[model samples]
Target: MKILLIGEYSRLHNSLKEGLMALGHEVTIVGCGDKFKQFPVDFSIYARICNDNKIANFLFKSIRKVIGFNLEKIEKAIRFYLLLSKLNHYQHVQLINSDALETYPILSRFLYKKLFQNIQSRSLLVCGDETPIIDYLFKKEFKYSVLTPYFEDNSIEKEFQFPLKYRNKNYRKTFNWLVKNCQNLITSDLDYEIPMQKMGFQTTFIPNPINTDKITFQNIGITDKIVIFLGINRLSYSKKGIIYFEKALEIIREKYADKIEIIVSENLPYSEYISTYNRAHILLDQVFAYDQGYNALEAMAKGKVVFTGAETEFLNQYQLQADDVCINAKPNENEIAKKLSFLIEDPEKINKISKNARKFIEKEHAYKIIAEKYFTSWN
Candidate 1:
């Protein structure tokens, strides 16, 4: 099958493309490199005038401040429209999310209608926050979600512009249009699947594909000092519950200065970010999720003891025990600290979890196997 994937996020589409290709399917991905992380696409749709260049970025920011509209988004929309002629007539087409192109709603609706008309089988993969997920979070359905901080305090609204934008009239219109056009809706994890199901949308839940072949599992060599790595994305610091992890880190830092080493990286490119965590025995991933995201899966594939979402739903789905693969991190500072201290005191559990993490990824999220599942779903 010849498949066309649109958009990238933490190498989700890139890994899926690799998996599909490995299964003998021709695949083409069109994205704007997911900004900063720079995940590659077969056919890129980046704005030439308002992208990456320091001067252009400054000029565009200034323009947006005055014009009340983003110049960069318009530039990307125009670029995506021009590429539409080349993206047509695919056997299967899947968008990473509702805002796949990150363009203006009216323009995106017009452009995406063309793409949808051309593909034989259409799919919309809800891998991140969207209309329903945000709505669900606002209703306080789950015990704790990414929007927990925002609900408690609305002062840091700037940090939540992306997800909050789904509340925009234009964004909501575009989201509905995309859903209406797509032949199928797919959820990549329990975080999305639960809300989508409650909203009465029949969707398929496929785990995010991880290329285990690329990320070779390395047995952790922990002798005296145990290393822990925490990665922070400034944009999502509050949303992903990074502050709790930071507080936990502080506790770990002061109490176990002799036994534990802490490493913190901020907003590095995907290539450098993955490699930077190589030496760490434990990696701190997101706190407010019911299942692992792309980064957590990659870290697990690399045999690192990852602190990510492995809640009851996730464990029951895979039939695993607590701390079998990765630790389940809820949105609490003291609890997270307790979990870290438990691992710190017992370094032996870290090694066991590291090995289990790799095996879990290989069994549940191997790219080739996941690719086959996606192929079957699309067909």
Candidate 2:
């Protein structure tokens, strides 16, 4: 099968493409140029411009790093422009990732309608995320599929992740498009399926695929000090739980004070990221949720016991208990301290969890398995 995946998130397609290729399917991904350096995909489609203007992109992204915006429409508009530039530069096969859905409504209707018609005839469009655009373009005549992120059974993070506001000038139009055109909706979290299903859209469940091979999991024992990694994108601190993690660090240092080491991986060079983890024992994944973000997953692959409060599908897939694979702790100081104290007090537990963490990933979350799922979905 010849598959085309459109999205800016490199990790998303990197794993999916690897999985699809392993299953003997040919895959091509269209995304930003930056993705090419870290991940090599079959084909590359570069989105030339930044949204909100290049200056706005820089300022907004920079400001968003410290604090995110509360304006929904503005946020959605920015995303739309980013994606429009993506489509404008897109020159390849037709399947679309819903990364641009929020912005599609406001897009030049004439161009969108033309593109929709072109895609309808040229390729089987797959919606990777849930957005109104997916619904609008879904038609009986057009072949399409949706695959999304999935959370665990009991997810507190979902409350924060899903947007609730529904006022939009073009929403009804998009909704009507979806009802009339889409064939299926797939979700990483099955919980999201209900809403789509209620809309009478076909639904399926596919967990987020991680490219395990990229993560070099190693077992280099403790050096003189232990490292606790705190890495979040240059995005907002609230959603990523940086503030909570930082506070937890304050408590940890006071309690241990020169006893344990705390290393924060900021916007460092790639070489530094690898070496930093090698020097540390635990990498703090995230605060507000479970499903270790890419940072934690990468750390886990490197044989480090990651500290994350999330327990999403990926965690459950490994059959790992809270303490076995990672040090699951709340954002609160006391809770983080308790979890930290246990690992610090017992060197053996760190070694055990570290070892198990690597083994669990190999057994359950290997790229081989992940690729299979991607292939199955695409083919």
TM-score of 1: 0.97
Candidate 1 lDDT, tens digit per residue, 197-257? 9877889999989998998999887887999999989988988899889998898789889
Q: What's model 2's lDDT at 195?
A: 38
Best by TM-score: 1
TM-score for each of the candidates: 0.97, 0.66
Error of 2 at 315 (Å): 6.8
> At residue 181, what lDDT does model 1 achieve?
78
- Cα lDDT of candidate 1 equals 0.88
lDDT per residue for candidate 2 within 1-379, as digits (tens), equals 6555544342556666777677777666654423223444343333223343687667666765678642333544444344444343233233333333324454423334544543432322332234442333233221211111112223443433322112244544544454344343444432233335555656565555656676776764775666777765543344455666788788879878766877776755444556666777887766654445455666777788887644444346556566777776455667876788777777778888878877766775677686665445433
Which residue pairs show collisions in model 1? none
Instruction: Please give the lDDT score at residue 11 for candidate 1.
Output: 90
- For candidate 1, the 10 contiguous residues with the lowest summed lDDT are 43-52
Would you list the C-alpha lDDT of every candidate in the order shown? 0.88, 0.53
